[model samples]
Target: MSDYEISNVDPNQELAEQGSDNFWLIAAIGLGLTTIGIGIKDFFTSRKLKQEREKNKLYQEVLKKHQAQINELKNEKERREYRDRLWAENSN
Candidate 1:
């Protein structure tokens, strides 16, 4: 029997196994964080878009009501102007 004979076990194999396990653990943690970050970003973005759409709808309704009032006022002004013109012509 010699000092370095008949041993098939490798110390490097244990190191390789440990390295592989660490690599897998790091990969899983990275994937989990990426998924969580995307979910949070999407939730906030969706909420902000919904709020903006609601605000725009309210503004559109206000604009429609204001336009209707302006049209009515314009019609009244035109009627008054026509009456004034007829009165002036009759006087002349």
Candidate 2:
């Protein structure tokens, strides 16, 4: 047709340009995310470890406080007796 013949744009050129632009954009975004992840990877790992340790420390503290209460129970019951025995073994 006259329109196709008169047009300055080539169909292949337009397709190639679009594909190259999308590829570069995706590649750049992927590279940026990878770099950011690498840079902060250690920070997230250390923070997770720190949180775990704090959780363990709090758990131990709770047990220690509960043991003190169990030791104070004047009337011995099955539950109290069992807790006290476990406490005695772990205290040393």
Candidate 3:
């Protein structure tokens, strides 16, 4: 004698109603998965770009240091050649 008791519901109608609601549930899950996929892809791509920029900066720094060392060696060689020339002239 409960007031909340349902007595004559058709099983086929209940199944059909459930099937209709399931469409929205499936659609929402699909959209969520696609969003996550795109987010992951973007994260990796941005990380790779950042790493490449850092590597390029390091390479440029190393190149600058190497050039400075080469210039110092050139200056030393020129000085040594000038000293040798003066010594030969003074000996004569």
Q: Would you list the C-alpha lDDT of every candidate in the order shown?
A: 0.97, 0.90, 0.95
Cα lDDT of model 1 by residue, 1-92, tens digit: 76576476687999999999999999999999999999999999999999999999999999999999999999999999999999999999
Residue 18 lDDT, candidate 1, scale 0-100: 99
What's the lDDT of the predicted structure labeled candidate 3? 0.95
lDDT of 2: 0.90
List the lowest-lDDT window of 10 residues for candidate 3. Answer: 1-10
TM-score for each model: 0.82, 0.40, 0.62
Give the number of the best model, judged by TM-score: 1
Off by over 4 Å in 3: 1-31
Q: List ranges where model 1 is wrong by over 4 Å.
A: 1-6
Task: Estimate candidate 1's alpha-carbon lDDT, on a 0 to 1 scale.
Answer: 0.97
**lDDT, model 3, position 12:** 93
Error of 2 at 92 (Å): 46
Put the candidates in lDDT order, highest first: 1, 3, 2
Stretches off by above 4 angstroms in model 2 are: 1-5, 45-92
